[model samples]
Target chain A: MPTISFDGQEITFEPGQTIIEAAMASDLYIPHLCWHPDFPPHGSCKLCSVKVNGRICSACTFPAAEGQEVVSSSEEVRQLRLRLTQMLFVEGNHFCPSCEKSGQCELQAMGYYLGMTDNHYPHFFPVRDIDASHPHVLLDRDRCIFCELCVRASRADGKNVFELAGRGIHTRLVVDSPSGKLGDSNLDVNDRAAHICPVGAIVVKETAFRIPIGQRKYDRRTIAEVSVAEEAPLLRKRYEQKED
Target chain B: MSKKKIRIATTSLAGCFGCHMSFMDIDERLLDLAEIADFDRSPLSDIKHCEQCDIGIVEGGVCNAENVEVLREFRNHCKILVAIGACAINGGIPALRNRCDLGDCLEEAFLTGIGVTDPKVPGDPELPLLLDKVHPVHEVVKIDYSLPGCPPSADTIWAALTALIEGNAPQLPYELIHYD
Candidate 1:
């Protein structure tokens, strides 16, 4: 058993476990954009940057090694994560006040966790079309951060309904269909990728703002804190009842 | 050589005084600050305007007419200009309206909505022209440093001040890496 400490709390892992797997088994969550248990880790979003023995590395891809002191809370590491967050915030039209996602949004929670009080960068103001194509969902292109979690989930889960187009900053997630809408695509409502988005960029239609403020996931604590507590038996039972 | 007594000035522009209050929250660190830096024309201290200082901390967004003049004066006077807090950094809450049409907001807030009075826009007055959008300090003038928080925690202010005293780039706190 090799020992690794996450934020100074030591945990032992089997020799071949990735940080995400070890963290999930032990209840620590490394905030990720392109990682899922069932699907292969994409490591595209880079939101999960953590310090491994003083070097910043993505936790989702990093193998947990013996005697490694991983720090997710160092000043330099947190700022780097925040810059990614800021890029995402300004990259999209994140009007928290008007958004139906408001309090329930993971993007908002992460922004709060990262201490993003202002949109410091230039506003892209990229015009985006709203796709009301799905019967139960409203797709807003302006809100997408291009994390590609949706594409992986759809592909891995045998649906193969979603994909990404373009490259670099212009890259975007696309639904596979003639109309290219979720309604037109062969996606089932039960796809895990639809629910696993860290932000409400790809949300279930018409359920935006359904949960009132002070009731969203990670609303009270950082995702790291929430994930740590979620591993406990008592909290796990409580969390299941609230899971969407 | 003895520690050079750095001169400093502070100005509050078109924003709530929260950013200025953040500086005051430095508590006992002000005692150490007095030893290393001399207050030149800070609103919180005896000074009223710039008297040639080493650093200037500008608080608030550029919203009204007087803000531009004051900001320019501070930039011209201080050797280093730092934008303090969310308002100075990114126009804060006021900037939310930057997305909304200004004419619509003015009509709703002043003329047709609650507390209605058709007020004439002042022309030959001391009032500054209102820009269509709120702007961060850096957009108007060059900024040497930016301390961003809603009102950056007192710890951040202290760290930034101490870094300036030591002539080093202050590192951000681990708890606050993403400031807008």
Candidate 2:
């Protein structure tokens, strides 16, 4: 067993367990965006970054070893997370006003919680198109954070509908075939990508305001808080039971 | 009282009280703040009416008529105006509404929606209306300092106040530096 301490709380884990899994197994919260238990760790959002022996590493994917000392809430950790979240904000056109996902939006909540006040960086405001082709869903390219959660969900879940085209800063989510609008792409709204979007980039069409602002899923809890509970075995088992 | 001792007023306009609360969240250190500064007009203090203060901290956003009046008065009275919080510094969460047309929102919220009140909504008001866009404080007024954050962490707040108390420009911790 490998042991680790996050901000002084000790947790032991089996070999190969990620710091995120170990932290959650012992009830320690580590904030994250692109890492999910069911899905492999994609360190894009970088919110789950932590300090390991005074060095920054993404906890969602970092391997925990014997006597590994982790610091989750240190100033260093916060600084990194803040920059990452800010990058996500400026990287997209996240005007919350016209967005149907305002309260439910994770990017807004994280930005606030982490104290991102100014977009110190220039707003790229890259020209992105809104795909309203999907009758049941809307894809606003400007709002996408490129977490690849959607891509992972589609591929892992065997749908093969969503895929990343291009590379690096120019990367984007695109339909699997014909390059037609998502509505014409034969994609389903119930796909995993639709459910895991951290922002309003992908939203269900008809139910935009079906749930009021204050009542959306992640509005009440921090991203760390929600993911920790979801990672628990008992909770996962219970969720699976409900689905079955 | 004694030659106005650099009158400083703190007020919150369209934002969560957290920034103001964080100001008070300084806890016992507030006693130190009280000693050096004269509280003229602050939501936390009794003195209303901006009586030509030296510094004004405007929090939140300009969503209503009252906000416009308060912000304008602060700009008029204070020698230095600081935009605090993401809401005041930028449009913040409230600015999210800026994406939608105010006229349409007014109709949806006050007229056709479930919370319909006076069937006839006022087409105009006494206060100056916000522009089609909700802008950051610097966009509206000359901001002396911008302490950003949904509500910046308490440590950042402490550092800012300490610097102000010491008559030195506050240095935001390097690790705390984040551009929204």
Tell me how far the alpha carbon of residue A139 in candidate 2 is from the true structure, in angstroms, after superposition: 0.5
Model 2: what is its DockQ? 0.12
Pairs in steric clash, model 1? A75-B174, A100-A209, A118-B180, A136-A205, A137-A205, B65-B128
Each prediction's total of clashing residue pairs, residues at least 3 apart in sequence or on different chains, is: 6, 9
In model 1 chain B, where is the ten-residue run with the lowest total lDDT?
A: B171-180
lDDT of 2 by residue, A1-244 (tens): 6578779987887677788878877767777767667777887677888888878888888899888889988887788788887777766777665567866777776765665556554445456778888888888887898888878887876877777788877888787757657876767878776777778878888887787644665556655566566667643463456569
Worst 10 residues of 2 chain B by lDDT: B171-180
TM-score of 2: 0.65
| Model 2 lDDT per residue over B1-180, tens place | 643355678887767797888777778877766777878898877776889877788888777657777788889998877777877755677766655787887678768988676776655667466555555555556677778655666677778756765667666753343322
- Please give the lDDT score at residue B174 for candidate 1: 41
TM-score of chain A of 1: 0.85
